[model samples]
Target chain A: MAEDVWILGIRMTKFGKHPDRDLVELAAEASMGALADGGVTMKQMQILAWGSIMSGGMGQQLQKQIGQTGIPVYNVANACATGATALRTVIMAIKAGEADFGLAVGVEKVAGAGLLAGGSRGVDGTTWTPRGPVGAVAPLDGRIGTETMPGVFAQIGLEYGHRYGGTSFELFAKISEKNHAHSTLNPLAAYRKRFTLDQIMNDVMIAYPNTRPMCSANADGAAAAVLVSDTRLRTLSLEQQHRAVKVSASVLTSDPWEEACQVLPDVNTLTRNAATQAYEAAGIGPADLDLVELHDCFATAELVHYDNLKLCESGGAVDFFNSGATWRDGRIPVNVSGGLQSKGHPISATGIANVWEICHHLRGEAGDRQIEGARVGLAHVIGLGSACGVHILEKAAA
Target chain B: MAAARIPLVDYLRLADEPYLVASECEECAARYFNHRVACANCGATAFKEAQVPADGVVRAFTIVSFAAPGIEVPFVSAVVDCHGTSVRANLVNVAPDPEHVRTGMAVRLTTFPIGTDSTGTEAIGFGFEPAAD
Candidate 1:
């Protein structure tokens, strides 16, 4: 039988622009924090995996930073889901019985990175390269598609508003305010200040319907998780066992090219598909969840996922918010860690960062922002390919 | 001198009067906008060449105020369902406002120059315009 996995330790650096720190130092800080949290030493980690985007050859360099133990290291990149991908990799290693104690680290330095600062700079910056689609019916079919995440998501907000017929823009503002307010309680959050709905709505518009506050910042940070298999947990010390949080379900799904046909592609068909699978794998539904940490790359994205994850009816998101269903003290409190909206989305680090937040909830250690009796928590992230990874964790069976 | 023209995408070639080219799958009657190695729908490799009608309905659109450094701002980005396939591009020849660009609006495919090379060669790309009656 495949053995169950437990998050023995999870930690992340305070998310913000760490211009003084490079990727290796960021990763080392996170990994060491995780190691200390799990009560494990570098020598004990059987395998190490990293989730990074565009770090060229930082995988081996990071290993050296943590003391080259000659352990097998895997570098993974799946857009924004990179960190969760790393976590999933370690889960697979433990499931395959190839590893006992594993470490999964996700890191990204988006602050000064050319793209992170915004705009497509590089050798290709000024070059007008027209790469036409395969069979554009007309010369101009689908030509203005920009890779700016905000642009695409803003389009989704507009379409969703048109389809549903409501003040989605207002709802978006409320969502931003809620998340920013939550950030005030989260010390690890990148932007810890609260925002009024007017402030969020009036902020400079990056894309129509999406203001600066509505979109997560280009952030820099790293998060790491220590995973120990059930078999190994039996031998671990009492402290390790006490810190262990059970993984009830973990699922990752990529875009089904057909999703392109959807009017709001960013409404995320993949998240729906993955969430259903994750709920099934966890043997629980959205109703049973005590807390959730979804992508929230954009406020509208979060509103869309509320329906995609079956947390509420399709158009009931605004109502869900009004009813206080997703408030930090509501029926199913969400983003109490402030989410990517406030916590900072360091691309690759977001995956494990979500995990770290959920672990805090599951372990009953999330001091001020903690949800009462948050026994079940969900962590979700959607990559640019529209890839989605949903993971469910619960307090280990006593 | 008449500037040389180029297609932004590999599949595109001409800058003038350029219409969309597409591929049809033999296995499942699935049609693609351009030639694809395999059928996205039914997964059959057998394909036939076809061209999509230049018209589609505006499924969704946005006004992009920020983009890559070189890309212009405040353009109307849109997803037009051309020939059963979703094509994402900017809606041109229209104001970047809700009153001007609307969902379910009729749009026609058109191409415009993205930029010109210093060597007098212009790179052209495609977009959608409000369909004329």
Candidate 2:
């Protein structure tokens, strides 16, 4: 039988531009902060799994700044799912009995990176150039159709509206408004000011039905967590054990082959697959979840995910939002930490930061936005190369 | 000088009549754009060249107002469903706005110059335009 894993400590750097801080510095802050929070030292860590999108050999470089621990280290990069992937690496080690104490840190420096490109940069940046031993070729982006993040997600939202009635530009804007409103309570969020419905609706349009405000804020940040096996937790201090959050389920999935998926990533099917497996592993359903922090890379994405995560009935995401169930005070409050939109999506850091939010609510340390009695919560993140990760966490039993 | 023209992609045929071709799966007959080694739907290695109809209905679309460094903004990007196969392309010969473009709008394939090389060779790209029934 596999041993259980518990998050002993978790820490996240404020999500915003840190022009003075380098990637290693941000990573070190998160790593040391997590160690202190867990009441453990770096020397006690048996393994390290570091995730970053913009850098490599981060685990080794991170060790130099923190400590020269000779433990096995894994460097992970999976687009936006990098952080969750790194955390999962540590959990697997603990479950496999490889290590009792493990540390996972995710960091990225993408502030001012501008729009995320879907394909490679072509020579002219306008037409498709076939790859081969031939002349200078351009990218497939502008020629065929834009594979840009904003365009892809905007199409996804419009498709949902076409498939199911009741979704409109105003509805999508309303979703962004809610997230902006939620940001006011999250001190770590990049943009704390709330926007009215008109502000979100009238914001600079990046893509139709998705304005600039609806898009995820690209920022620099890092988040880290320390995990300990259940047995190790028992030997820890009484306070540490009391504050631990149980990792009931950890799952990661990729896009299954579908005709449509080959063209435009089917963010829906993979997310559903992960969610189903996570719920089955956790022995809980969406109904039982008290809070959720999902990847709202775009406002349009959040609506579709509400259905993909099974938080609502099939073709019922708009209705679910209309019911006010996703608000902080509602039945199943979501993105109480302002989500990726306001909390700022630092790519690799976002995955673990989402888990950090759930852990906060479960530990009752979420301050003003706390979801009272958040015994069970779920955190989700999906990247465009088509990776989806779902983790279910629970408050330690009294 | 009349600029020499060339299709932007190999899948587009510029001979005689301009139209798009796809690789059809032998097992499931699912059509896909460009070259494919196997079927995404059935996983069959065998494929046959199939010509896709020029006409399709806009299943989904977006008017992009922001883009990367060099690409122009406020263009109509759309997913057009020809029969059952979906094609990703842009809507052309029409204004990039909600009033001019919409889902379920009838359109057909058309080609336009993406750029011209120093040799005066024009690179042509495909897009969908409002179809005349």
Per-candidate TM-scores read 0.89, 0.95
Cα lDDT of model 2 by residue, B1-133, tens digit: 6667777767777766688877888898887765566776778899988888889998888888887766677788888888777888888999998888878889999987777767667877789999997
Quote model 2's TM-score for chain B: 0.91
Tell me the tens digit of each residue's lDDT in model 1 across A240-319.
78779998888889877563443345546788899999998889999999999988888877777787888988776667
Q: Provide all candidates' interface root-mean-square deviations.
A: 5.2, 3.8
Flag clash pairs in model 2: A122-A139
Strongest candidate by lDDT = 2
Off by over 4 Å in 1: A112-143, A259-267, B1-18, B110-125
Per-residue accuracy of model 2 over A124-208 as CA lDDT, tens digit each? 4433345542222455666567877878898888888889878889999988888989999999999898999998888899888
Best by TM-score: 2
Once fitted onto the true fold, the runs of candidate 2 whose alpha carbons sit more than 4 angstroms away are A124-139, B1-4, B36-42
Residue-pair clashes per prediction, in order, are 17, 1
